[model samples]
Target chain A: MLIDTLITGLVAGGTYALVAMGLTIQFGISRIMNLAHGDTIIAACFASFVLFSVFGLSPILALMIVVPVGYVLSDAVYRIIMRPLVARAPNAGALEVDSILVTFGLLFVIQGVLLVAFGGNYTGYAFLNTPVDLFGTIVAANRLLALLLALVFGITLIFVLSRTRWGMTLRAVSIAPENAPLVGIDINRAARTAFALGGALAATAGVVVSMYQTFTATIGVIFTMKALIVVILGGKGSLTGALIGGLLLGLVETFVAAYIDPGLTLAATYAIFLLLLILRPTGFFGQAG
Target chain B: MNTTVAFILAAAALAGLAIAPLFLNAYGIGLLVGMTGYVVLASAWAMFSGPTRYVSLATVAFFGIGAYTVAVLSETLPYPLVLLCACAIGLTVALIVGLSTLRLAGIYFVIFTFGLAELIRQLVTWYEVNVTGTLGRYIFLPFEGIHIYWQLLALAAATLLLSWWINRSRLGLALRAVGDDEVVAAHAGINVSRAKLMLFALSATIITLVGAIQAPRWVYVEPAIVFNPTISFLTLIMALLGGATRLWGPALGAIPLFLLFEWLSANFPNYFSIILGVFFIGIVFFLPQGVLAKIEGLRRPARKAPPENKERSGAA
Candidate 1:
């Protein structure tokens, strides 16, 4: 039972870690909290659903199509909707407000499209439900696939972010945008690329998530909140922290549901979130100014 | 002389709305009731969020709490007492939450408030299942739809009046200063937290009362029904569309948008959210400051001030 629960928790945590990393990357450079991020996930889920149900393509194959679309669409969104707000916003706080409001509108647009295209229905498609053994523990193959994909995406991001010169420049932009321009780096282009990359990560998570779990049109906001919570828990601009925090959150939730009451999962999440805010407002990997 | 004219005009408008149910059919009354509810909700939300610039998504949480309070108590207590308890409970919760979380940056607070409804809904669901052995409550009050309308109308008037009064008071000045810059407000000897807490609690109380008043409309009280997270979004949009920075801005946004939504829902139910989304993006792109701001700007073109100048304060 312990092994089963731990495996389940880790699988869940892997997806969460990827989702949080996407948000942190976008927020790190772009400074725009994309409220519609989960909608992008939902859109990809629907797209993947269509690919499987109609074209009879595997979700793994669907990723190739959906991810690039996600990147391009998000880039278009930034160019059309967000660029003006970024330019007009006099300060970071004002930009935050404008982004929240605008993305809020964007959230509804995406949700509305999903709702109209596919009525408010719970959607799912089974890909690989066969059992797999990992360390003598039984787990579904789809879930394992999800875990592996999340790890690959997350690790690749960390590598690129840490090792490459371009990634370092992006990090520098996130860390000190004012200084980046002084160093002759084009901060605007870097921020846009980061935002689009974040959207692509969301698309990746969406495909991975839909492989195992059922989803609905209205469930996007809940995912947004969950990702936002993980981002706050992990700390700003810290991928590794998001990884640890996401896994911890998943374990905590699973344990609470298993030992205590299943209904207490959300309550436990809130309790820990509130406690963390009160105790360490900057988060685990955050620096105090 | 200006005050008297303004007061008389407001009074006449209130009187007109108060007697509206007598002339209108059930449909009109129902429409007005919803519009009035949003008016109060958006206005009350604007009272704190407008000047403070803290866009709170906890509106549904407090509103749901007030609804639950009434749902549990309306059977045992009188209507007025039930309302009072709901208000008191909402105020307490708001004070505690505001004290703890309002100090965070704008984005953090927005996310915190965004998650608050879901958290409260989960807790409520747990309590209902474990403690009460039920997930829903039936609120059968001795109140008519017209009664709900009148009460909401009175509340809307009160919200507007209070907002107007605050706009002229020292607290309003302090709140504006805080909204402009928290550090400067603190340096200027304004107790920033106190001002924010007071308004937060006050607005929360009104929102609670709205939930209490509208309980009969639902008839069945459940965490899912009462704690609809969309309420927060709707209220925020209405307030922003109207421009929270000004008195009556939310109402101006709420009235037209509410009517438009009603029409859209009726005409193209499936396309309702889609059209609404398009409308929201249009507003953010064009009338970012709100309809009132656009109107006021056009009305006084020689003022040489853009509507969003307030956002520029302390940004440098």
Candidate 2:
């Protein structure tokens, strides 16, 4: 039972890390909290569901369509909503508050649109239903597959962020936006790229989630909050911090569910989050303000 | 606007509302009750968030605690006493939370409050599950619609008066200074943390009273219902939509917003959320300063022409 719980917790944490990566990058670049990030994931899940149920396409195949669509949609949201707020704000602090409110508005808008389109039904795909044995513990094949994909994407993100010129530009923009422009890097283009990449990563996580879990339209906000907790716990802008934070949260939640009442899991998660905020606001890997 | 004139006008409006239920039917009274609740919530929210510049998403936490306190105490105590208990409970919890969280800046403060709210909500749910063996409790209150309406009106009036007083007080100046720049305020001999904590407790007290007043109308007290995120979002949106910076902004925003919500919910229930979502986004993008601010802006040049002399003198 302990081994199974450990495996399950690690896998869940891996998926959470995948989602947190997108939030970390977006926040690092634009300082927008992106409350709509989870809704974008929900949108991708719905896309995969529609494609699978109607056209008999696999969720993996649906990703090719969802990622680019997510990119465009997120970019449009940033341009139409966020850009105006940023332009109006007098300083970075004001911009942060404005962005949070604007993103919250975007969250409701996305959820409303999804509700209109899909109603409030829980949807999932029944793929890879076989059980697999891993070191004396039995697990679902789809969960393992989801974890594998999350890891692949997560590693690729780290690689790209560290090794590519585009990644360097993004890092520069995040660290010193004023200096990035002085160094001839087009800050706007880098920010736009960050949004697109963040959207794609969110969509990828969504596809993995849809393959393994059932979800409804309203569930998006909870996931967004959870992802935010992971990001904050891991240290806001650090990819490595996101990984560690996700794992810690997942383990705590899984253990609480196993030992205590399942209903108390969320409560326990939030309690830990609050304690962490009060005691160590910088999180595990974040720089002290 | 003269402070004394605004106070009188607000009192007169409250008096008019107090007598309105005598002629109106049950549906109108019910609508007025909801509007009054929003007025209290929005104004109290503006009181704290406006001057401190700390955007809190914890309204639901105090509100839920107040509601549950009423549910548990209404059977044993008189209604007025129960309301006071709710305020006490809210103040105690706010004091504890504020002390721990008041030192964080901006986004960190916002997230911590939000987390605290979610924590309280979950804890309440857990208690209900383990202790009560049911999701919620039903409370019985012996009050008519008019009586409840009057109580709500009184609460709303008190909130408005408190807001007006705060806007004109030395505390308000210190709070505004803290909002503008905390370090500067600290250097200028203001106890910034104490000011923030006091306002936080005061805001929570008002919100809790509003919840206690409205709890009987709900009939049932559930963690999910009382601690609903929608309440927090609505209060925040209404306050911002009316211009939180202004004393009367929340009332101006709440009346139209409550009416529109009523109309939309009754007519096109499925599309109501979508419309509201669109409205929220539109307001954020186009009317961030709120309707009151926009109106004030149009008349600012005329007002400022005379103020230029005062500004030069102040600068000199």
Candidate 3:
């Protein structure tokens, strides 16, 4: 029983970790806090739903197409919108509230567009119901696969961030963008790459998530809040922290629903976040300023 | 006090509103009420943002608190008493939250406020599910001669007057000082903390009153509408569009946009949100200072002295 629960918890945690990693990467590398990241995920989910539900394609193949499309859309947003913003305020320590607002506005625009196009209906795939029997328990194959992928992605992300030359340049740009330009690193190029990678991660998670639970356009708000809580709880710019926080949160929420009233789960999760903020604002692995 | 001018204008506006039911359709009246609520909420939001330069994204939290307070209390208490309860709750929450988070500067404050609002919203949803069983409380219309329309009008008037009074008060000067330069304000021996707390409380009170009026109009108060993220963003847009620093700016900004929203949502329905979001984003990127600033510049092109020059003259 415990193993089943742990496996279920880890799989759930993995999907959250994927979303959290997307958020943490942008936050760690560019400090943009891409509030619209989850919206992109929701949009991609709808796009994938169309491919599977309407066109009769396999969900896995649909994801292969949607992930790249998501990356391209995000890259366009970064170049046309965010790049100009950075150029306008080249010496700033952080992006302005206006930048946040613009991204947030984009979130609404994307959600509204999806809502109009698809109507508000929960979409899910049937083939994803393939389950793997472990002892007496049955776990969905996709959930297990997603969990394994998340672990592999998490370790790979940490390795890339900590080891690579591009990673070193990203850290420098984050620490000091103006000085980074002086050192011959192209700030715009780095930001675009970070946003594209972030977008792909979000879309991948979205595809996996839809396989587990049905989704609608309105799902974006709740998903965005969850991803944000995981990112914040894990600590800013810490990939390992994202995984740990996501796992802890997934367990807590799953247990909270199982034991206590399901209605209290959101409040409980939020309370934990508030406690974390009061106790350790920097998060578990985040450096103290 | 210019009581005569105030009374005459009040009487004219009230007379127009009272007769609105006679001339306009239910849709128009509904849209008007919504616009009025946004006006009060938006202007109250501006009171603090203009003076303190904080651009408080947490105004919705207080607004939600006030709304829920009214919704819960209206079940037991009179409507007027519900307003008082909401005001008190709003002020208390704002004071505690402001003191704890106000010290953070710039983007951190915005993030904190955003988190705070979301927390409160989640709490509200939990409370609604557990205590009220999802549907939540509804306000009954006009038990006596008093109607929702009149009550909403009164709240709007009170909000406008409060905003106007603050604009002329010493706290307003302190708030403006804090916005211009917090370090300088502290160096000048201004009670920066006290000034901000006061503005926070005042803004909460006004927005709470707006929420109080809003509860009865919908005849139902649910967590979703009370603590909606879009409503918070809309209020910010209204305040920015009109002019955050100026009195009546939010009203000027919100009234027209609210109408536009009503028109678009009614006609296009699905595409309205995309259009609104794009428009808001374009405005923010291109006009960071807002449309009101451009209008001010256009209205008094020659009268526009540089901010530094004005400061130097004022200092001398």
Candidate 4:
């Protein structure tokens, strides 16, 4: 039971980390707290569902199509919806407020579209339902595959971020936007790229989630809240923090539900989030604003 | 508006509300309750968020607290005392929350309050599950349709009156300064943090009472229903729509919105949310200063130009 719970927790946490990475990157670079990040994921989920049910395409193949579309759509969103706000904002603080409000509206729009298209019903499809053995514990094949895909995407992201020049440009833009331009980097292009990258991650997370979970059109806000928690817990603008924080949240929730009351898991998660925030205002590994 | 004219307008509105029950049917009075609810909430929200520029999403937290307080105490205490206790409890919670959270600035403050609200909600749910074995409590009160409308009307009047008084006071000046620049406000010798906390607590107290007044209407109270996240979003949007920065702005926004929503919800329920979303985005892009400013601008040509000396004195 314990081993099964551990694996389950890791699987859930891995998916959460995948989601939070998308939000952290957007917030870290473009500095827009995209409240609609979850809507992007939901849209991707519906996309994958359609590919599988209608076109008989596997999720892995759907990834190639959905991810690029997410990137392109997000880039367009930044241009059409966010550009005016960004142009008018007097400072980072104002941009954050404007972005939050705009994205909050975007969230409703996306949900409305999904509702009109799909109706408000829980939808999922069977994928790799066979049980597999991992460290002598039985787990669903779909869950294992989802975790594997998340790790591949997550590791590749970390490697590219740490070892590549493109990654260096993003980090520079994130850490010092004013200095990045002085160093000859185009801040607008880099921010646009970062926002797009976050969208790609949202698609990736959505594909992974649709594999093993049932979801409704209006449930996107739950994912946003959880991602927000992980982002704040891990520290904003810190991918590594999101990864570790997501994992910790999953494990804490699982362990608490197992040993303590089942209902206390949520309370435990936020209690720790609050305490950590009180102690480290910027988050556990968050940079100074 | 001048003090005399504003007073007359306010009194006339109150008188209309007082006599409205006689002419309106029960169904119409119910609709009025909905309108009053939003106006009170949006106005109360503007009282603090307008001046301080702190976008607090915790309205439902104190609202739920007030409701839960009444649900637990309505059987033991008098209705009036129960309402007072709800206010006291809401004020205490707001002070505690403001003291801890007001120190954080920008997005951190927004997220902290959001997290705290969710935390409170989840905790209440957990308690209900583990201790009570149920998720809801039935509330009983002597107040019915018209009585509920009257109480809500009184609440709205008190909210507008208090907002007007504070906007004219020295604290209002200090608050606007804090909104524009916290550092400048602090350096200029205003107790920025305390001023924010006071208003935050005050608005929270009113919101709590609103929840209490509303609880009997629900007849049943639960964390899911009372602590709904939608209420937070709806309140924020209404205030922003009318312009949170000005007195009477929320009411201006709330009245037309309430009417429109009533029509849309009844006719095209599926498209209601989509239109609401468009409304939010529209307000930000087109009317950032709010409808009041837009309306005020239309009559600009009718007013005579101020004397040349007025410009030198910084009067418009």
Best by TM-score: 1
Give me the runs in candidate 1 sitting further than 4 Å from their true place: B307-316
Residue A89, candidate 4: C-alpha displacement in angstroms: 0.8
What's the residue-level lDDT of A237 in candidate 1? 72
Please list the residue runs of candidate 3 whose C-alpha ends up more than 4 Å from where it truly belongs after superposition: A1-4, A54-57, A90-94, B1-28, B53-55, B58-60, B105-109, B112-125, B128-134, B141-146, B168-170, B177-195, B299-316
lDDT of 1 at B37: 92
Arranged by DockQ with the best first, the candidates are: 1, 2, 4, 3
Model 2 lDDT per residue over B1-316, tens place: 7968976886787788889899999999999889989989999998999877688888888888888889888989998899988999899989977876787766666766665666777887788778877778889998777777888888887888788788789899988888777888889999988999999899999999888888888888888788888788888889989988788898889989989888988998877667877788788766776788778667876665332111111000
lDDT of 4 by residue, B257-290 (tens): 8888889889988987787788888887777667
Q: Which scores greater on TM-score, model 1 or model 4? A: 1
Question: What is the lDDT of every predicted structure here?
Answer: 0.87, 0.82, 0.75, 0.85
lDDT by residue (A20-95, candidate 2, tens digit) is 9888888888767787889889988999999999999988888888888888887887787777666666666777
List, residue by residue over B29-143, the lDDT tens digit for candidate 3.
6777787788888888988876676757777787788777877777688777888888888888787666655654444455556656667777777766778676567766463
lDDT of 1 by residue, B189-300 (tens): 9998788889988999999999989988888888999999778878988998999888979999999989988898899988877777778778777877788888878999
Q: Residue pairs in steric clash, candidate 2?
A: none
**Model 2, chain B: what is the TM-score?**
0.91
lDDT score for candidate 1 against the true structure: 0.87
Cα deviation at A235, candidate 3, in Å, is 2.7
